[model samples]
Target: MLGGLHFWFEIRIFMHFIKKRRNKPLYKKFLPLRKNVQNRNKLLWFRKKKWQKFQRAFSRLKKKKLHDPKSYFLSTFKNFFSRKFKYNLQNKQRLSLFYGGFRKKYLKRVVKSTLKEFKSLNKHVTVLFIEKLETRLDTALYRTHFSYSFKNARQLISHKKVYVNNKVVQHNSYLLKKGDVITLDKDVFNFVILNILDSEMWPIPPKHFYVNYKTLQILVIEDIHYTNCLMYYPFWIDFNSFLKFYER
Candidate 1:
């Protein structure tokens, strides 16, 4: 029951952030649920992936069964959302938000922004768009194994422990640019070294970041230009469809 509550709390926060991206401040401390949080098992998150998957799949399957699609399970195996291309666009938008940690408004904004910046899609703007997301502080931290999870990375940033270019930036959405250097507060840096550095989480940091475990620092090497960014998630979503989702 406690594990269930924690999982829901995280989902709630994610959904809330997307809905009120700029309108509202986050309720990091909850008056109503503070009691539950106080007793939460810190280790429960280690198994959270399995737990979340089970709950989400079971609930979604139950709903699908109740709705009774025309083709039933066939619809799932092959384009369950719809046969139309529009469904692909929607799915890509959703997956990009869910996996990339983008808000709805921000997701569309990113799409439009990238379109204008590149001035066309011929530059493989989809890859560039994904590159932007990966450069976000929280996502970069998670990728580099600086933090155990995205939420953890966000918490560290919000606590003013993470620094970029020698300045503390609380927003996890802060974008890292080429030549920007990242470091953590001394106490937090030592703590990370004591725990995370030796954890074999990611044995090798990707080439795009110059990580010095000894210095407790990370430097943006060059803007990564990898198309395989989408492969990071277990599921499939087409970036091309995401691009098409925008009005041509």
Candidate 2:
């Protein structure tokens, strides 16, 4: 009877083990289905949020009177013209500042002549013109080790202490052309050489220009190209828009 009881107990335990194993498949199948449902719901929620964001942006744009084609075009044109006018005014002010201390009429004449020259050169006023202005005798002196600053270079020129092609130039705006040779007076040369040795003011020369440190002279070997000028002084003025606004 004890053996029969033991056998019955073993059978009961075996049946329990089989019953648990059969339930495992059901748990596995239902658990994965539940997780898949959760993932699908999460994806839907994310898509709904993205759609809401897009809707808000669209509503804002519509409220700004941008939904109508004619209104959109008019608003765009107004903004463009306003910005262009403001830039042109700033350019005029810069030109006036460049000729500072000169008579207003003379400044206006210079601006007009410069604009006319730009119009005659290319359909767009290229950066080469700006480079020409920047590489003038006084400007070059300031850029090289000859002068402490551009103002100092201008003062030196005005005092007849600077020469180009072996002739003294009093005007600071005298643009240096290709193949021009620049030299300094003996006194100014000695003074600047001493300063250069004392200070760490040595800057690389411009690509088209070369400076002889030994002889204290500069030579413009080539003309300033548009590509090179753009690399140096980049301006935000759009050439096509500038031409259209000026009716050039």
Candidate 3:
């Protein structure tokens, strides 16, 4: 009788284990629901945090003289327009000066037309323009120290010593794209290796261009970062002014 009872207990335990295993699929179905609820809660938490930050900023603004809603709104509007106008004037002057002599009447029209075209082509005109300027074959060669100066870079290109994507390109103004490979002619490559490599006058390549000193090759990795580009040519253009001008 004891053996039979033992056998019956074993059967009961086996059945319990089977039932628990059967319930696992049902439990797994609810697991996704739990995870989704958790994700929603996290999103709500982030939104709440952002709203609180905005409220704090608004309160700080209120602590300033902008206590009344009408006054606050008016002051904000005035500040915005003032900043915008300043930016527009700066870019108009800079670009006008760059293209040619700065004539207020002529430059105004040029700025207006350029802004329209930029708006159609890209959302960030300043970035696009800087990218165009920095990625030219001559500019890249100069930055890579393959040429002593931008003028030298242009000369090298004009001599048919620069190859882009394995095709000889004599144009110094050829724009480079990401992953475009630039190779120098054998004579130029040898000259750079002997005369320019490790020389005191060798320039450090900008962050956007990758140089292979061993192979005398340059790869355009990406467009230069706006901040870094500014550091390199601060006087060339003012980005804030450009934005303001373009928006207007």
* Candidate 1: regions farther than 4 A off: 1-81, 85-90, 93-101, 120-122, 194-204, 227-231, 246-248
* Residue-level lDDT tens digits of model 2 in 1-248: 99999999999999999998774421122121111110111222334553554333233333223212122111122577686666564444333332222345553454455677776676235453355466667778866758755666788899898889999999887888889999989978778887567545433456887888999989989866666553332122233343344443
**Most accurate candidate by lDDT:** 1
TM-score of each: 0.61, 0.51, 0.49
Give the range where candidate 3 is weakest over 10 consecutive residues by summed lDDT: 32-41
- The parts of candidate 3 lying over 4 Å away from their true place are 1-117, 120-123, 198-203, 234-248
How far does residue 130 in candidate 1 sit from its true spot (Å)?
Answer: 0.9
Every candidate's lDDT = 0.61, 0.56, 0.57
Q: Clashes in candidate 3: how many?
A: 0
Quality of model 3 by C-alpha lDDT:
0.57
Give the per-residue lDDT of model 1 (tens digit) for 152-219.
Answer: 78888999999899898998878899999999898787667755654554334556788887888899
**lDDT string, candidate 3, 124-241, tens digits:** 6666666665677877776676765565677788988989999999876577988999998997777677546544432246887778888888888876675665544313345555
The regions of model 2 sitting more than 4 angstroms off are 1-86, 89-111, 114-124, 194-203, 234-248
Which lDDT value does model 1 have at 247? 36
Q: Any idea what lDDT model 2 has?
A: 0.56
Angstrom error at residue 17, model 3: 99
